[model samples]
Target: MIIMRKHHFLLSCIIAITAFTDGSQQHRNTEDVSDYFEQIRHDPSSLSAFLTAMPKGADLHHHFSGAIFGETYWNVLTESNGWMQPYTIEVDTAGALHKAPWIHFATLSRESRFDSLKQAFLRKASIKDYDPSAGPSDQHFFSTFSRFGAVARYDMKTGMQEFKQRALAENVSYIETMLGAPDTAIRLAAGPAWEKSITGASLSDSTTVFNTLDQVYAALLKAGIGNTAKKFCHHQDLLHQQAAIDDSVFMLRYQLHGNRNEQPLTVYRKLLIAFQAASMDSLIVGVNLVSPEDGVISMRDYSLHMLMFAHLHRHFPHIRYSLHAGELAAGMVRPELLRYHISQAVLIAGAQRIGHGVDIAHEAASIPLLEVMRERKVAVEINLSSNEFILHVKNDQHPILFYHSHKVPIVISTDDAGVLRTDLTEQYILLATRYPSIHYNDIKAIVRNSIVYSFLQPDLKERKLGQLDSAFIKFENQVMFH
Candidate 1:
């Protein structure tokens, strides 16, 4: 009987040990599950998926002209009725085919190079090299746009379609793009007609600007690009109204421009007039000075443009701006100009966002300036590929990580996606791989900031943010199960 009791006690000891081991194993597996979830939720596999799943609010800084890509240019230039020009296919020193003599070639027969130009354009068109070691210059970089502008100048249908596809891919729900108005083009095309229109009470009259925008907006809408992407968040029927206005499908925003290199007085007057018209029509949100960056007039009149934005801000406080400032580096602009480009944009011009704030560290009193930006919640539109390609600022050289650490608002964007042969997805991937320490949560915040800082209507923005949250939740749940 004593031996039997001993055996039973041994069996009990074995059972206890087995249970303890099972419990310990379960605890370890639970800890691992938690860690895995954190990584998956914080830094998902695909940056594109993260962006797509992210609730993107707005794309405040977008240029309609630059947003369109090369293939669309090739397709439209080939198909347009009378809009084709002779596209010279010349191989440069690098063995890449590039179109030359833009002015003269804009007049060629559309049918001339229809067959071979498509493939030729693709082969020669520039794409981002994805190399951190090398980059392009500001002048040489922006100059490439002029080379391709001839192809993109044809139609709105192809341009808008491609724009939609890209915006969707980038997880951008809304975009505020700047496009040339019909009147601006007409004035350029018919110099005499422009002089005649402006002779009577300047272009500031809301009536006149609205009329021009109306024609262009109608053309875009009639091209069958309405309520397709999503609902027309806001639309006002114009037939009954005094002067008509037809808004675009997406939460589209507009900005007008004047030549910065032109006379100071001329630039100011044009800006004021444009701002007034924008406020009156509620279509335009800002005015910009676009031209070559290194030109004599752009340099001389840089301060003058900032002064104009400051002066006009008081009158049209409703209008918003995200000016291109500090897109230069050490050698691109004079030393004196570098210190104040971004400063003036923030202080003098009252810019809501600064495009390509590449040289912030180079700017004088930059710490305080960054502080001001942080306090005010003004974001820097970071185009990583653009910075690497144009300014060649890379690795520890780029200040994006600095901005992140300092709690400054930042949004990763594709500055000239088509021109660079990249997308927003590519930018996110670049950031993820380059800065792996910044996990998925931090990246999501940047994605959130993109929409939070966008130029969309307030209500629409809120709605879109809600949708983004839902996507993030869905993505998280799927990863948890897996």
Candidate 2:
């Protein structure tokens, strides 16, 4: 009996020793992985592989136009079967697109007609000589889109596919891109055809007159005997890579903007169609009102549009919304307007997320909403470069640090990456540098939050989220322990 007890004790000791040794080896491996990731974090070029390995779940606020590269837009324009443009641009002001206003378009161009026009057009549309110290930098940044819009409208399908390709290149596993839908495309087509008919209407009368405008616009949109619809579908199908469409977890959400330049009722009709599409189709996720923040029309309808959203939300409670609110600051919008924009977006429109919530601190009623956002898990999409360049909101003054303190889930995004001349990796690095309190794990947590905050159908999201976790665990084991 004594001999048997001695043998059993020895066996138990052996097992304990083995476990201790194994645990020590595992600890060493984990430390090694931590060191590797730290090294990669310090090196800008090494970020891609590390980021790809990280379980980056989704890009919640990627703009479709901005997500696409300028090279792609240029290539698309060049390859179009039927595209003609005789205009060009010249820089009126070195860093401000809106300046030198005393000079008219004709006066701005003086060289040989072609060279002058070419130079002018390039200055207007492309980020030719953007300066950091300029007043209202977004004036130049967002204005560039207008120079290229006519060319971009020539083909929509190619643009969508190209955007998807760019998102994938950034190692984004999932995306909910914001696009201007076909309904808006039709209105844009018909806009210039009737310039003389309504040129002299008063602002008050313009609202009532837009009732007639809606009928005409709808009729115009519904015109062409379905051929345009068929053509659009065919082009989209032709360009869409089947494997990419299948393997990619990319989902596009159309953001039909009510052109601030148009009448309120016109905006309402556009919003209604956009809302209806969201209510009816899985492809259409939400309706957003977009245009330049400082545009005369956008400011006029700002409150009226919030009221429109309130009316629409009552009918389609299930449809999701993520508003581009508080993107404006002192120079962008009047200080009086700032207080209500974000409040109305949350209280009136019931936004699920706020894109570029840079001016939240400037808003009077924003504190309660901030608390609500934290409790409700309503995320704020943070696009570092866009916010920095547009609103001059960066460093400690940026509201995201406050949002973090309030526990508001934040998903770092690329608002207009190609347009802003920045990438998601650069944005991430910038945020990390600017807000040093956030750790690597905090970044991962934000990635997870982006997926959770997405407007995707619940079942598929759960399944994909499960797959993401599995992938993350597998990669972590391989990289950290192997």
Candidate 3:
């Protein structure tokens, strides 16, 4: 008995020693990699190569339509017999642009004028070669969507496949992309009912507001909105199957979003449909509000939009959402408009995440709000390039470091990568170069936050996290030995 007890103790000690040794070695490896990163941090080319090989966990704030490159949109347009107006480079699927001024893609291709036309189209369709003197950067960035929207939705499968391929190449393991918008028919159908019900009902009166929303909800169901949600799910399933976008190495999920720059009734209907669809579809994980936050309608109906979200949350509490709040700067809107968005998004709308919380510093009770975000684990999606181009917020002026200092979870994302002519790697590069204070382990934690804060199912999230763990082990090994 004494000898057996002694042997058990000896075995326990050996196990402990082995664990400590392995853990210490891992720490050393990470430190060594960090040192190497510091060495090449000043060299752009080498830094790009290093970060490109690093495994990025997920892009939590990606937009599907904005992810497709200009070249891809052009190819889809030309292949589908679309015509482009030479002056504006705007495309029309119908023969609307078939008159003298517009050129057919077939003729351009036949005459070898395709390359020149494509270059011109690229200039207009993306921020490639954009001149700041020509217009406001934000205006240019937002206008690109209209130019490409005619063809952006043509080949959903191909566009998804393109994003997946690009993600895999950049060592991104998962993407929770925002896709789909409110159904126009449903919005129109619910419009009259919503306007009538909400006309006399004060937003502050919860009972009256709730009853009014219920009436609109009933109207939406009568108008076949539920069927619309189901069809949207079915279409997503077909796209996933056709594209084979998910595998052990890469996974994709989607969020249905609504443009907030619409009328109050239209916005509410869209959010309701989005919530209903997300509740019914596993692939559709969450909902978001998109479009320019500084637009007239978005600004005027901002608080009302939060009230709409709050109403839906009471019913579909299981469905999560991330909001594009505080995508604004001081001069972009009235100074007072910037003060309440991020706070209201969290406090009222119960947003699990916030996209482009750039104006956070302007938020009322900013420090307390940061505490709330940290305590509640409301992660912020940091889009370095997009903020720089749109809001001119970058470097020391950017709140990313402030969020980090407050321990608010931050996930770096590519906001309209195609339009910005950048990618996840470039975002990381900017992060590393601009904010050297965010060390290697801190960056790794941020990478993990992308998956942790994602709207993926609990089980799938766990699996992806485990996969990320393995990927990092392999990545760090290469960085160390190679």
Candidate 4:
């Protein structure tokens, strides 16, 4: 009995020692990652190269239409034999003419009149040359979408390829972008009756509501929207196969958008179609509210829309949606508008994520609101560059620091890379450079948060997280050991 007790004591000691040793080794590895980021801080070129290779897990707030540059869209149009005549973009205040949009003269005839207006067209097509002196910056940014809309609207296949290829090149493994089937349009005749039926309804009637919406949108699907999305995914599979890239190496999911600037019924129609599309296809993972959040109709009908989301979400329980709440500033919208958007988005609309939660501190119950967000694991999609450009929110003015301080989940994303001319890596750099107190571990936590809060199914998320761990090990070894 004495001998047996002594042996058990020894075994317990051995186990304890092994665990301590293993934990110490893991901590040392994480320390290496921190050390590497700190070392590269002083070397601009090396830092740029290093971050570019960083295996960012996912871009959760990307917009498919805004991901492609104006020049790329122009080229796509030309490739499709689409016609465009040279038209000059004249900002009302300035009669000053700038250089042509064409970066090169190789494509068009030198003698053609269109070549002379190329630069103007380029400026008109994107936020590349947006000058704040001419108009409000947000207006400039949002208008760029419509300017390029004519050409970009023609092809979803091209836009998907654009975002997917860019994400892959940047070592990003997953993308959840805002896109929808172009063929999905609301029936004007059904709008009034449909709105009347769902008005003031509760989640308990989700079945009836969803069924009615499904029937309304069903008439349009056979025309090609369903097949458009199906072909898009199928084509992507074929392309990935052709390139010898495994499907797991690059994954894509979509979030359809509800344009808030439209009428309430129009918004509902879009949301219903978005939910239906998500249900029809596995690739369509989530939905989001888009367009300028500060627009008159958007602000006026904000709560009503939240109620709509609350109702629809109950029916499509599996589908996830994120709100572009608190994307406003002091002057962009009225003082009252900022007080409850982020809070309502979570508490009322049941948003799984919030995009550009810039005005979080201005909420009615700011501290308690933060508490709820932390408790619920609701993430904020941070678009540092875009927020600064559009709303003049940055540094301490931005709620990212507050979110981090309160232990809220946040995933840095490229809101509109092409429009903002920034990528996920640049976002990381901005966060690191701007906030000295932000640690390497915090950045790492958010990377994990991005994948965790993403719309990926539970089992797939687990598998991808394992893959992320492996990729991190390889990446650390390359940069740190060498």
Which candidate gets the maximum lDDT versus the true structure? Answer: 3
- Total backbone collisions for each predicted model: 6, 6, 0, 3
Candidate 3's residue-wise lDDT over 438-468, tens digit each?
8888989999999999999999999999999
lDDT for position 21 in model 3: 95
On lDDT, the stronger of 3 and 4 is 3
Off by over 4 Å in 1: 1-57, 81-116, 119-137, 148-153, 181-250
Q: What TM-score against the true fold does each predicted structure earn?
A: 0.69, 0.73, 0.94, 0.82
- Give the distance in Å from residue 383's predicted Cα in candidate 3 to where it truly belongs: 0.3
How close to the true structure is residue 238 of candidate 3, measured as C-alpha lDDT?
Answer: 87
Ranking by lDDT: 3, 4, 2, 1
By the lDDT metric, which is better: model 1 or model 4?
4
Q: Can you tell me which runs of candidate 4 are displaced by over 4 Å? A: 1-26, 88-116, 181-246
Task: Write candidate 2's Cα lDDT for 163-199 as tens digits.
Answer: 5665567656667776563443444444554433444
lDDT against the true structure, per candidate, is 0.61, 0.64, 0.86, 0.76
What is candidate 4's CA lDDT for residue 34? 84
Backbone clashes in model 2, listed as residue pairs:
88-117, 88-121, 89-119, 89-120, 89-121, 90-120
